[model samples]
Target: MSSDDPKGIAPPLVELPISTADRGFYDGFSRQVTIPAKIIVTLIILWAIFFPVSANETLSAANSTIISSFAGWYVYLVAALIAICAILAIFPQTGSLRIGYAGEKPEFSRLSWFAMLFGAGIGIGLLTYSTGEPLSHFSENPDIIRGAVQAQSWDAVRPAFVYTFLHWGFAAWGTYALVGLAIGYVAYRRDLPLTIRSALVPLFGKTMSGFGGHVVDVVAVVATILGVAVTMGLGVEQFVVGLSRVGLGDWLLNPDGSSSLPAIALALAILVGASTLSALSGVGKGIKWLSNLNLGLSFLLLLLFAIMGAGLFALKLLGQGIADYIGHFIPLSLTLFSDEGPVGEQLVAWQLDWSVFYWAWWIAFSPFVGMFIARISRGRTIREYIFGVVLVPSLVCFIWMTLLGGTAIALELNGSAGGTIVNATMADQLYATLAVILDPGTAFAVSGMIVVLLMTYLVTSTDSAILIVNTINGAGDTEGEHRKHILFWGAALAAVVGSMLVLGGIEAIRITMIIGALPFSFVVALMAISIVKAICYDLIRKHQGVPTTAVGVAADKK
Candidate 1:
């Protein structure tokens, strides 16, 4: 029962005595958050409060400038790195390696594992971008704009779908997989804490437990909070749009056509309340059920869109998009424009808005979604993890994007809705597309279903993010996660979203997302290196006829 006991139990490193002065506040979830992390989080909150718009403008400007300057190289490099990890995981030497011990089977069923990964990995992002991304690309992708008039016509539709898939497909999920593989291998296979810093143990060794590791974990916590907040804030905006689409009227819209404050408050209240309850219920029940429900509802919605919308056009577009995506994959993956040419400048501008933004968004998301997937992915092989986390989700997103986005583009091509679907706000595009395809009653019903689905997806994402942040801040105590921690994070998320709504609106959400992701991109690259280092070390030990298991490695070190 002592603090240093090694029977699968450990106690706190220090205990405090009652002070003479009584602040009388409870500390329910400070187990693993170092003093430095607490200070950083407090400072960030204070900064957001005191100078919200300035923070937004400063971060946004910095991010935009940075992304614009190095976008060509940064975007292609990340895409290449993710693809490399996926390729390496497919090799016979590494593919079959278990995430856990030699004979351990996966903790969750395949269905549950995939559901959770898909739910957490994409969540409302899939809903938000399915229509918006493709439409945006169709209207003015770099290639289309640079080409002749034909490229700007209906012919660009296929290319538009291709680019959208490029953003959401293998690269996106593969980014998540690389991070998860590193964390899962280190945590489950090597018996380290399930913190982001644990992925660096191979590189830093003992230093991972010192200042270096604390910085890594603190950066991860901050990234996860801001990343999830961005998603939540944007999702709430879309939720309000859905409300208006379903006859909730101008109550959800401001006089100036912005989202109403009262509407946002109500949306945050419901989202936070539901997410806290789900987080308290733990992953096995509440999160799992919601994820499954989300999947089912999403499929149903897709089916309706396929049948009621432009089915033939979407199918045609899907085929062409896949072919185009494959054909252009190499160029798209590696191409980075120089500043010397007009087209190059346009490409950089395009990338800063689309590709670079997405890369940062996904990188920011990796710490949370990657860790969440790794938690459910115990005992899976490297091959299974890579395929499940990367390829499968990419395909799902591709199909969803095709069905939703393809239908919208086809409507515009046919001159049915003209520029309305294309000109509508990003948050309103899906509802606008729905209006084109379905009758008023049907559109209202479908919008309602979407709202419900969005609600559940939001809750699933929020709760999972809460749990992931809790695990990191609680010193990676997965099994003994505190409910009070969930409550705290839920409230914190609501506050962040509410503050952004009041202060900088959508711009604040976007700015924080990119800024939070900037530091973590370096962390993920290091994680990839750490994974390679660990695997190489394992292979070397095996060749030398030394033990390579976690216990054996520890013994060798000792």
Candidate 2:
């Protein structure tokens, strides 16, 4: 083992608290994720841009069939519970197992940790869906869906929060957290590469050295690129639409949502331009600053909405939302209703569209997220990592939605924020609804703020994903070695998002997500198995006199 190699990667090492290496596990786990991530990511971006739009329809339809076909719906229910239980089996108050490299500590601070972890994972989704979802659910609330109550019952309000929790709760976060934990354990604790194939090390052991490992790595990267590309595409569209509502430009005004293709293309070009500029500036200076800005905007907006929207009611709903979340959490988390009633049907469709879709998205993006998590979690403990990675930001996001979304629901009900929100679908109308409710002379000012917030978030997401995917592509190691590679993927993401907007819009991104998600589910499943195996191996090392910490493990590698 040496300090530097052909890929600019330091030589592999072992890290645990113990002294001896189980040669089989060590060798397999020590193998590298050697591939050009941005190259494949760029190809997928080009494909989305140039590929026929007809596939969007086919993919969407297939997504419908595939998600519904999951063992009468209950299968997904069962799967969620299984995932949650498995992860907690190794729960630490802080960090999880990791494979340390260089001088990197795999863990980050509690607050900084959540900002990056949650922001990288779902910040885009939070902005896009928060208000829009609650308002929509109020139209025909969950009590109606559950058959336990009617559409207009107060129960309606409870179900709005209940179903919201259902969509974003353990099932979704659990999936991402597990993948992250696995990658962290294998990479920092065992000194593995930051690639998906490395996830297989705990199971395949020494067999990962040959073509099999490369094949695994390739699939993981491809699935991740497309998955993330679609997200970027969808996010850009929603952002553009939101900006348009606030008077950003004529580029956003496509009444048919069709005539706006050229505008969307222009929008894509701008994002590409900005992403390139950010990419050139490097991660610490440009990307991190913008990410912090985005986070600040989100927090500010939440504060304003809480002060102005429904005030007391908003605060109350957040508390109640948590209660609702806790009470209905397990049942909702694992629910798989086969009743086939209108509510049941609607719930099923929403789950497919929202929950299952989110699962697929996270799975597709797991390698990128997992790689990033592992990189930051070098010296942290299992429990602390889980808290930041799962609980901290999620609770923040949940409260944000509650305060904002709950207020929207209240306005619609009380004739304050108005019923216009109940009708808005695209994200911009979300703010539009808020504006009308607040009805401040500062209405125009608020709109301007939201538009700016959208742009800031877009920058953060694109750069982080770019830097992360580049690391994966650059053979699972990131640093000065992958700057050009990161820029390539950044530009590609803009291209894909732009093309999709021209071809469709949000519809286009949804299509890509469905198709990309299918294969990635298998990847997620594989990761699940690999993690279980790693935990087992960890126990053996802990009990059998093996070094389990990074310093000890690295010492043995010499």
Candidate 3:
């Protein structure tokens, strides 16, 4: 072992070289990583297109098997990830470690950084689920199913927010933070590529440079595509609903009230086309501009709720929700329900649909979102990155859920909505609640604004994913010159969402995402272990008067 090896415990900080060479068609792509990932994604898209029924059934069966077998594993893994984030942030040694070279400043301003973070991280979810999730939970949650509180009653409110906050809170963002922290640490300090395999260096070391690394990158690419496809599928459903509400056309919806396949295809085309263009403009310009715009619109929408809706009730729910969320965080995070009896089956099913599904989605999404977080989060300490990436966005989600979802619940309680908000389709709840709160003209106007906001969020998310996938495929090169690659991935993403929507609507997308997330979840667990090991070893190196930070290491080499 070298002198820096320290009893052969610390893995050598060797940079794994990833090649991006010109194959005739796949020019500027990593042959091993990009080719395999493309083959897998293309096969899935073709399957969903040609054999829709078979693909749907297979996805459904696979989702069932995974959920039933790995529900507890998912729960504990995510909870442990959150715990790892907490430990990293609370400890002085790890928390104070900069994400980039010493003296490096943040690339984006705090406002822009936060806006992009929200937009790329969970903006679609806030719009898609802020009203729907809490309202659904208000009607029935694990607590309600267990008879701890009556459904849709005053007693249901706290429990509803508990589960809502649980899904959207630290646990969700911690998944992303841990991945980002790992990648940023490796990429900046150790001079490794900013890809998923880099985060596993401390664990697998030189093995990451071979087929093992390519497998990790391929999994990340596939997971990112499916994860973003889920968001796109759901967003398109709500986008169609918003269009119909704004007097666009009834053709946007089928008779049974789902988004029509034609409408979904058109929306996907528009979104992916726009996203491809924005991605060509690169992260610094197009994404930042759109993120800022959507964040402003989000604030406007939230302000409308604060003005016209039940502000005091939402405020009260916010306080109690935080308390209940804290009190029940442990149980909610780690609890696993058995599918043994009627009540047990109901609880387990609920967990699968809500908690487990959210965990899978976030884990799958971490590659894209986590890499985006790391790209924008250079120069910040681990504590700051955790706070900004996990805590702040989560608190914003809580406030959003309280104000929007709380309004829907309050309207139901007061009978002003007459069950319309609760009875409407999930995609239609936000507009339904707004109509109940505002006059028809005002509701129509606000609905138009929401559609615009939704469009921006979708564009931001799609573009960000396109860029991140390209980054991984190009071995972490973020150059904006790869327009062809961007366009190809954009079309691929559109095809994925469109074909899946045709196959089984959002359900197909959800099942595929859950399945895709499973493999990557194991990767994330390894990442958590790798980061802890790296940090501890670096601290030991520091105590032994060796260089640890990027600057120190660079200077020592000189």
Candidate 4:
């Protein structure tokens, strides 16, 4: 009787609008975000106050385990596979490549859209690894973890690029496009919320009105947080490396990137604060402006690397790389050549190392890009969305890889840079390579710019990721969310990343990423299936002479 007649009881509700003037302000979402800004700032101060000076053996072991895991799933095989899929996605007639934006064309000019997506998406990875990865894959000793190879070998580069393309290519982009298309299709056509749950609208129908749907949304939010957290972790370390190489003084490396956590945390706080402000300004004013800045810097860096980086050396190696990329594109793409078969499990090892890891990474990274894409893609058609999301960005990556990576390889092979650059791996590769190609003053200037560029991107991604997580928390409130919610994620990210860094540095984080990426692969795979079904449903309704629009709207509401 008391339960039935409960007085002053609050009504149970589902979501709150993240916008400032909403009645449902700051339930799951925060508004205007200065509080979140301070939380991140606080973490930064704490980290700077407690910086470590050295890595323990356990930390070293954790790094080893993590990097080894990436090699097992992602190194070569998965990369090859992803690239093949991407190529297929690009060809329009393949019907298999169709997206939710199938019925219409893209709204923005193709080039600008591509520049935004690629800059926001793959730009972080390119800044540090573009040149180094290609070369490492070629060498026999190319960091394969357990295998005792000494150099990457000429044969390794082809498979490496092919695999890199595989992970970054169609499969990866498809995941993003598929999610975007589903939400965009429904939002543009069916009038659903632009959230991940909206993509599952067809499966649950009205049943999503319950806890099950809420759980689905929750999973997406967590994934988005971890994914962005890991990326920010990498971005921070690389930012430090680049700054030091360019002369930010001894504190940058400290021989133990993780030891100076307090300083690192402090720096990251400033970064997250600025980024949160940017996120509060909405995508156009903040994210878009920074993206364009990245593009300009990228253009300048490429030009400088090409002209001043020993032209003859780069030109020759790039020619070889072109042949390598082309000749092996298909074989590499399809090469599942596992350890159990004639082709050798070496490629399988590579897949575990890179492809699988990247796929997971992308899936984790998806919500941010998806949310960002959703912000930019309002007016475009289905076809336009597919091309812009998948095709344009891939080309930009390919060109950037060619110029930057090719130059590094060329320098190493010709002894122009004395093999100083490519000879190193991961973070070391970038710093050492710069030192080889550019004069001390010039290299320092260029490398320092790289650090700034990296910082801006790191901040941009964190801000976007924070906004996305907040958006998900607020049930897809596109208008913005609670400022406190923004800070929660920023601090959470800083803490999570700081913990991993303290435990094992980049190696620890990379392993965590690979582990994180695994389960999500299944999620994306399921999404792909759901999309295929949705498309087929559309075709089915049309074939039966039903009103396709009516069917789509019905499907959406369901």
Candidate 5:
């Protein structure tokens, strides 16, 4: 270890070498991550441009049949690993370890920190799914009768909220927490690059700096693009739908009354343009302000939904949903099925559509979300980080889903426009629900709020993901993002979304997302093991009175 090493500290097993490559393609781009990632992205764009229909069809088939068939394994494995993350944080031996060095104060305030992380993590998803998921579950939940009136029973309502909670709950955020803790510790404590490969330095030592590391970073960059693109596509589609509902323009509506391609492209242009500006302003001002704005708008939307819709019933569902999520947390998380019996058949189908798809999406997005949170979480202990990352946002999600989703469910049960919202397309469910529950004027006003909320969230997510991808490209230099780099990614993301919109819309996006996520699934498992190894290395050295040289300690052990 160096003479400057702190007490109770040890050096990393290998020093990460600094790159001196030429920045040729783009004026300030790092050849390591930027060149390869951009090349692959360019190739994808070319394919999508020249062969859009064939590309969409291939991905759709892969996702629907091949990927969905094995999705059970992915869901169960991710759930188990995330559960392990939660367990480690609660374990006394490891929980107290600071992400930074001991006694270092956190850089950002608690409120700003929470606002930033929460906004980036699930902004677009909750906006899209908060109402649609619950309403969809109310109809499709096999636990109760499929009829409109019969679906409002306790059996149906309980599972609708429970399953929603499960998807957005502990397991999902736990994935982020796990990745954040690993990367944050390495980047802040060990003083390594903030890329995903740095998280494995404790396990692989100097080898992480070579070909293996380049592959890891490349995978992360590609995954981040596809993941964020999927979300951007969803947000844009919903934004267009909201605009149509708000009577923005008749031309925004398709011939079949759906959102048109031109409308989606317009939304993407605005989203990407604003997000590029936000990225230019850096994280402190524009990103922070937008995140706070998102939090405020989210709370306002939730409050309105509660007040306008069923107040008492939503409250009741909130309590019961928490209880059911806790009660079935273990079994529901672990359950999988084959095509044998009728119930089993239903479960397999449900898993494929909802639970499995959600796990894959979360996993796909974990690198961007995780790294963003890690950048903000500089000085928090493992326990504190876990609580904030896993628990707080989860509580926020539960309330949001229960209030919005429960309101939709309650409206259905009360026989006031419930069936209409359920029958509407998933993208329009939120607007449809609000229209039925609130007065026409109020519903129109609330639709406007939804659009603004989605815009802020869309901007926050896009900007943060872009910054993270740039950080990975710059070898984890968060403050050194180039304007061209930001613009490049912003435009690239918009192009991807627009192409998918032209071809098959949301289905095409899903197919691309699952393809990107498949490799990262293996990455997630390795990251969990790397975190465990890092913690073990720390604990063992502390207990054994080993020397401060990280490599020396390992040598002594050997």
Candidate 6:
């Protein structure tokens, strides 16, 4: 029923007719959503497996076109999402609005909440890129390309972090925060299903309950799978490399040093198996414990670098990098270089490779991460959720990049590593850095620790993703007793990653992820608009003295 308001005033919330029924294998699943999503994902995986070269070439071409055509869109859309989040947090009326019903408290402790947030959102990324990204940018960024700084020199350090922080900072998390806030606001406050389609109620109304809704959820599911697959694919590569570094044998490596098929298969079997079991255990027990453990291990690793690596240099770089990142945030977030000439071409290509790629990756990844954040973030105020989701993890990532990547750069500067760290593959840079900074015995021991940590991160990320995917498919029935669905998704995810790696290595995964992210980016843009509209309408209801809180309004109706 509509609230007692003027004819022109909108209802405080619209409850959609979302339905899920028991299917034989997919108990509590929304067949409309899950069936199509599975079909599309299966088709892609089969294409890659059956026609490897064709799939790789098609994906590459599609990736190039999307980057060239939509680079500016990705840049501006992500930047705007961050601005939207900031506005919601700063505006007193919206900021103070709680995510859940009145008087409700958070379901998770602050530490647990933060741990899950960091672990699920960017855990694998930090391990994968902390050393590689910074070192790559330190050697050459847009500033270096533009002749504003000398590569690998003192002049390059600040700019290196400027770009590194750009990729991992607020913009990345803002995408997640906006989506999470939108879903949480409606799902928790208005008692709607916690699916991607629910966030679009304000924009589409009842249309979101029908074919339109299924389409939205399907797109989200596909995006989530591809997004998580890319991360898993990257993690598997690092996992295998970590295995080789710790004496797992050259059988894990090919003649050219890439991961062998056996390595990929073994990594997937372990990761997916662990993740599936964790997903079956639900978010509270398995996911929470693993997140906390990984957080602890992460701190231990960071402490190792702080004690034995370039502590002073990393500290200095941390401060300067943060400052430069803040100073140049806006220009970097919005600027899209054009293809004018050789230099322009280089800048555009770099932006496409780095900034645009990161934006797409974050967007693709946002559905899973955002939904997970929303799932765990009940009872938080809009302000708290935005800040907690966007700011905290980002700062943590900055510190990680500075400490781990800064150590590598410092070693190179001081001639201790003599380019060994930089020369190592992106997946092996962390090991190389550890080797240079620690004694042989100590390095081997720490490398073993890192391998374990990487496994935890990979498992945590994969399990969290599998849970989110099933949540969407189940029409937001997060606690559904559907171990079969979880198991199926885990296998499917492994297949996707394994086939893509076999097809075109990590490059194929990257290309496909970028393409998958494109459609969801549009969905996210709509979510931003819908949440703003819903919040604005809620403010109007508050002013008019209509009960705006879900619990209060429900009591009145009773």
List candidate 4 segments past 4 Å from native. 1-25, 28-108, 141-160, 256-259, 310-349, 423-425, 542-558
Clashes of 6: 0
lDDT of candidate 6 over 220-257, digit per residue (tens)? 99999999988898888888998998898999998876
lDDT of each: 0.79, 0.62, 0.89, 0.60, 0.82, 0.89
- 355-400, model 5: which lDDT tens digit per residue? 8778888888989999999989998989899999888999989988
TM-score of each: 0.91, 0.84, 0.97, 0.78, 0.93, 0.98
How would you encode candidate 1's per-residue C-alpha lDDT over 19-93 as one tens digit per residue?
111222224334345344556656666677898767777767876676566566457657767766766677877
- Model 2: per-residue Cα lDDT at residue 272: 63
In terms of lDDT, which candidate is stronger, 1 or 2? Answer: 1
Q: Per-residue lDDT tens digits of candidate 2, residues 371-475? A: 666666666655655555666666776787787777777777777544566665555656666677665557767767766776666666676677766555444
- The TM-score of predicted model 4 comes to 0.78
Which pairs, if any, clash in model 1?
none
**Which one wins on TM-score?**
6
Query: Judged by lDDT against the true structure, how good is candidate 1?
Result: 0.79
Give the winner by lDDT: 2 or 4: 2
TM-score, model 6 to reference: 0.98
Report the number of clashing residue pairs per model.
0, 46, 0, 56, 0, 0
Q: Which regions of candidate 6 deviate over 4 angstroms?
A: 5-10
Weakest lDDT window of 10 consecutive positions for candidate 6: 1-10
Question: Residue 150 in candidate 6 has what lDDT?
Answer: 91
Write model 4 residue lDDT over 1-558, tens digit each, in one string: 111234422111122222322455455442333233334335433443354333244335644465455444443433433443344345543343223333444455655666667656767788766776676665632234334433544444445565455455565676677666655544544455566665665554545444555555555666666677667777777776665666557765665433366657766776777777877776666777787788888888878877866455545554665566557656644444345644355655555556555666777777667766765676664555677677667666666666677667666666676767764546656667677777788877888788778877876687777777666656667675467666666767777677667666665665655555555444555555555555556555444443334334344345
Residue by residue across 122-214, what tens digits does model 3's lDDT show?
888889897899889999898799888899999998888888999999988999999999998888887888888899988888788888999
